[model samples]
Target: MNIKYILLPLVACSAVALAADPPVEEYVYGMRLDIDKVVAISEPDELYAPCRVVSAQMTYEDSAGQLRTLEYLRLSSVCSDIEGSL
Candidate 1:
């Protein structure tokens, strides 16, 4: 049996597996959200879908010492909305 023959197939299989993953949809970009007493920065290029797909919920603490929840649609990829402070 020739080892070379098996090598080609292995490389092709690896490539297919990598492509199977879905790309990121929604991105938090440069904005921050407050959750229920916990604040977390969203990952760069993080994929997410609003109501049409999976919703991203944020829970963190507020200045008032109360837990708060913010539900919003990620309009980074799907929508063309620019958010930033100049």
Candidate 2:
């Protein structure tokens, strides 16, 4: 008998639910290196020497307004002399 009352409540409930939902976050994978901060130089083994590297943790917001963080590695390097000795 009263469709308007039922429809109004339904619309209001939908709007509230959408507003209360948490923002979506995006998952990312990759390597980011900063060549400026080379902490040390040591050979982990005979084959590779990952130069100790340090970089600031990356922070940004995704498209859905969610806070995101990309952690940096403590040590990473492209060992050009992989065949050389320590």
Candidate 3:
């Protein structure tokens, strides 16, 4: 049997796999409010330059116990790049 013929299918399969999206990982995080104050978040340096804070809003609970809502600020960073040693 020729080695090239045997390897051809394996190479093709790997190529297709490589072209697919990366596997997603899910994680949860906890946060605390240290103090009530104006807040600012900085983008990680690896992200593309000129990152923008897209939107911001405030929500609150009314004295009557009514619910409130807030719009989240959207931030983008160049997360497609894998950084650091695996």
Candidate 4:
């Protein structure tokens, strides 16, 4: 008949579920990526600051069907119509 006791387990379970994803790894040049299927990817906000460097994440499955997460830096903008290019 205690509310806190019941809620504690629920909160703990939810946190574990949310953290079940694999940790992100920094991408390095010459690193072999055996991506077989892409599950999700972060999209940079190019409109905010076009040429700024931003962090990005990608979740995918490798050749052996193991889920993997990778984090890397990328340009905020990919468009060629910026001031310099214009």
Candidate 5:
């Protein structure tokens, strides 16, 4: 006899379910990144030997069904003898 009461509860329940966290599989899938194919370009310099990326790791996510990649770089400088990530 009261459609509004039924519809309101249904809408509230749907909203709660949608606000919950995603499944473990989906979370892992979105956070997975493949770094096996990443290669750093090396530059040769006479004076400092050029600062270059020694290693790289990428984290990828499927946001709204689109692939997005984030790169983390570990750089090495021959002149200052410094190694760090960026």
Candidate 6:
């Protein structure tokens, strides 16, 4: 009914929508990953870079039904092409 009351909910929703997501975790050598069901994976920016290391994010559910996210590094897909060419 009032302007203040209407604006309050809108502000709250905006805050939640604009909140920054946490950075993905970097993978370590021999680190154990417990990915249950794959939710989504963030795509690499440079898919065409040859032999270049690219960053990726994986969102998944763990064995305990907890949602988790992990970031890891991997060679670009083009690397395989180069390797195969040689």
Q: lDDT values of the candidates?
A: 0.50, 0.48, 0.45, 0.82, 0.47, 0.78
Clash number for each model: 10, 0, 0, 0, 0, 0
| Local error of candidate 2 at residue 10 (angstroms) | 0.9
Task: Give lDDT tens digits, candidate 4, residues 1-86.
Answer: 99999999999999998777887899998899999999998957566555667788999999998889999877655543475677
CA lDDT of 38 in candidate 6?
Answer: 93
Residue 39 lDDT, candidate 4, scale 0-100: 95
Whole-structure CA lDDT of model 2:
0.48
**C-alpha TM-score for every candidate:** 0.28, 0.31, 0.26, 0.67, 0.26, 0.63
Spell out the clash pairs found in candidate 1: 25-47, 26-48, 35-59, 35-60, 36-59, 36-60, 37-60, 37-61, 38-60, 38-61
Sorting all predicted structures by lDDT, with the top scorer first, yields 4, 6, 1, 2, 5, 3
Model 3, backbone clash pairs (residues 3+ apart or across chains), number? 0
* Cα error of candidate 6 at position 22, Å: 6.3
Candidate 3 lDDT trough over 10 residues, lowest sum: 24-33
Off by over 4 Å in 2: 29-86
- Alpha carbon deviation, residue 5, candidate 6 (Å): 2.4
lDDT, candidate 1, 1-86, per-residue tens: 89879998999999998765333334355656443356543322534533133355445566676545444454443233222321
Q: Over the full model, what C-alpha lDDT does candidate 3 score relative to the true structure?
A: 0.45
Number of the predicted model whose TM-score against the real structure is largest: 4
State the weakest 10-residue window (summed lDDT) of model 6.
17-26
Compute the lDDT of residue 50 as modeled in candidate 1: 30
The C-alpha stretches of model 5 lying farther than 4 A from their native spots are: 23-86
Q: Candidate 3's residue-wise lDDT over 1-86, tens digit each?
A: 99999999999999988755233222224422222332333334544455454443333444554433334545544322323222
Which 10 consecutive positions of candidate 1 have the poorest summed lDDT?
77-86
Q: Pairing residues by index, what is the TM-score of model 1?
A: 0.28
Model 6 clash number: 0
Instruction: Tell me how far the alpha carbon of residue 18 in candidate 2 is from the true structure, in angstroms, after superposition.
Output: 0.8
Error of 5 at 5 (Å): 0.6
Q: Report the lDDT of model 6 for residue 68.
A: 75
